[model samples]
Target: MSTTGAAPGLSKAFYAIIAGVGGGTGRAVALRFARTYPVALLARGEASYADVVAEITRNGGEAVGVRADVSDEKSLAAALEVVKGKFQGKGLAVGVFNVSSPVSIKPFLETKLKDLDQSLAANARGLYNFAHATLPSLVESVSANPPYPPTLLVTGATAALRGSAGFGVFAAGKFAVRALSQSLAREFGPQGVHVAHVVVDGVIEGPRTKGYIVEGVEDGKLNPAAIAESYWHLHTQHRSAFTHELDLRPYAEKF
Candidate 1:
């Protein structure tokens, strides 16, 4: 993504919503978007989003952190209500589904059925609820003529494309997210919404990945800030040239 200035005269009434927010990629994304629009960060608990929210606010950006569990429809709906209350008459400029379920890597024979169920419930079903909750607002934003297209972005992983050994459950869920994102893109692009799936193929450089070591390669991990920049670029792309899918990885990483 180029070093573009802050979005051109965006509708101040519009806000960006990010689900599955935490200290890593989620915090980076929230801060990036808050530069141009009020941002709402959602997580299952306050601890996941409080610091990020405070940081955004301290930087003179509008931010609200809401507790929400996307896996539960009721919880998601209530969170949307909070968003509505915050934005009032405004529409949704961007919606990011970054929810990642806990994945337990184990041999197929050792993996419990519940592991697969947990992955599916959080990744697939959570995104389903998020899409339903945000799409209407995104479609409404189109007519409002915001500075950029209303975008729905899903954060994917290498598992989204390949089910590697010991990662069956994770792959199943990520693959489902990719599929749904594509379907939404096709269905909503003509309606002026940009639905894109982003594959974060390598270990992200953050606290969570601190122990992930690649000998002799200091830059082998993807930076969350850089990923957020890419996401911003996707949101700002013109409708005439929308990207439905994108992948991010470290240059040192092999395919």
Candidate 2:
């Protein structure tokens, strides 16, 4: 990996990893964190993270894109092994779980079990696998005394807090992820790993959301870059001031 323009004072011996590197928040977060640490981008396909990797490299930051399905234990484990090889002796400074399952919006009667299963696999099981793969390295980094606290950030959604009529399955999965994140925070915070969950409660501004209209509210969609910045804040926070959860939404968004 090329470590051309790494942020000043940030240790090159520690790296960040972001899962679910697509064209949205995942890409933005990966780019933002790459400024501080060589990043490992994980996704189910190369097409999802290839452009982001190139963009990072072009900006003189080091990045590697590894195709792995977080919902699959073996796939994620193998991906981590690849990351280990790439970074050599580095430890994990930050880990972001940005994977979200496809939205299944239908009435409860129409929702199939498969939909619930898929969501569970992607949101809950994926995070489980990702945490298992990265937390050990994050813990080990504590002794290395990096510039900032080692962190694990999980991206959640409005569904994580409440279940809408058409969002039961998705909510179930998100809720499970939130619960797990909370548990992890309690268990790992004392170990020097900052585990936090972000509740993204509005439509995010991105290519996939360009056609989405929020009536007369200008700049109604949440900015992925802003979200990434918030994540960086979370990672940099002192252990004594650790934030276990954060909720982000557009100004006009209702609670």
Candidate 3:
């Protein structure tokens, strides 16, 4: 997947919703977006997320923190309401960034049925509730008098499409999200709503990945800014040339 483009003026994007704000990459992405957009940081860890919200507001941006466990459908619905209330009538929400990961790394043989259910609840079912509930706002934003495009970005991992061992359950849930992106793209692309899946193909720059240049790893590989740029590109692609899948990694990262 190639990275490129900016066919129009930048929208204020008054409302930028980012889930999973406590983790490494999610925080970075949220901060970057908040630099120019009103951001809503959602995570189960409110105590930690509060600091992030303050920093954004202090930097002359608007932000609010909401708590929700992606594993709980009801919790996500309520969280979405909080987001909607925060951005109510702000010309609709310009984006929904699904940064939450539902599964952890575990060998297939050792993975339990319960583990699979847990992963699916957040990765697929949670996403369903997230998008289905937010679509009206997205459509409203795009059809506003002046017009705007709303981006639904699902940040997926390389394992999502590769389906390697030790990642059976995780991969299954990720794959479901991949399917969700493609279907939504087809269903909503023409309506000025862009849905895209981003595959971070290298080790994300995080605590566990620090100082980690392994044979199969790219040190400082998938920086949050790089992934965020892909979101920008996906959102700004021309109507005739929309990119549905974007693969991102450092220049030296291997497949």
Error of 2 at 186 (Å): 0.5
Residues 140-243 of candidate 3 have per-residue lDDT tens digits of 67766322357777788887788987888888888898898889888988887778788878777776667887555444466776676667666656556777
Better of 2 and 3 by lDDT: 2
Give the RMSD in angstroms, all C-alphas superposed, for model 1.
2.2
Candidate numbers sorted by lDDT from highest down: 2, 1, 3
Q: What lDDT does model 2 reach? A: 0.91
Clashes of 2: 0
Candidate 1, residue 161: lDDT? 95
Per candidate, the number of residue pairs that clash is: 0, 0, 0
Instruction: At residue 29, give the lDDT of candidate 3.
Output: 71
The 0-to-1 C-alpha lDDT of every candidate, in the order given, reads: 0.90, 0.91, 0.72
lDDT of 1 by residue, 127-189 (tens): 999999899999998888787889999999999999999999989999999999999999999
TM-score of 2: 0.96
Worst 10 residues of 3 by lDDT: 1-10
Clashing pairs in 1: none
* Model 2 misplaced stretches (Cα beyond 4 Å): 1-10
Q: TM per model?
A: 0.96, 0.96, 0.87
Provide C-alpha RMSD values for all models, in order: 2.2, 3.3, 3.6
Those runs of model 3 whose alpha carbons end farther than 4 Å from true positions after fitting are 1-13, 145-148, 216-220
The regions of model 1 sitting more than 4 angstroms off are 1-5, 8-11
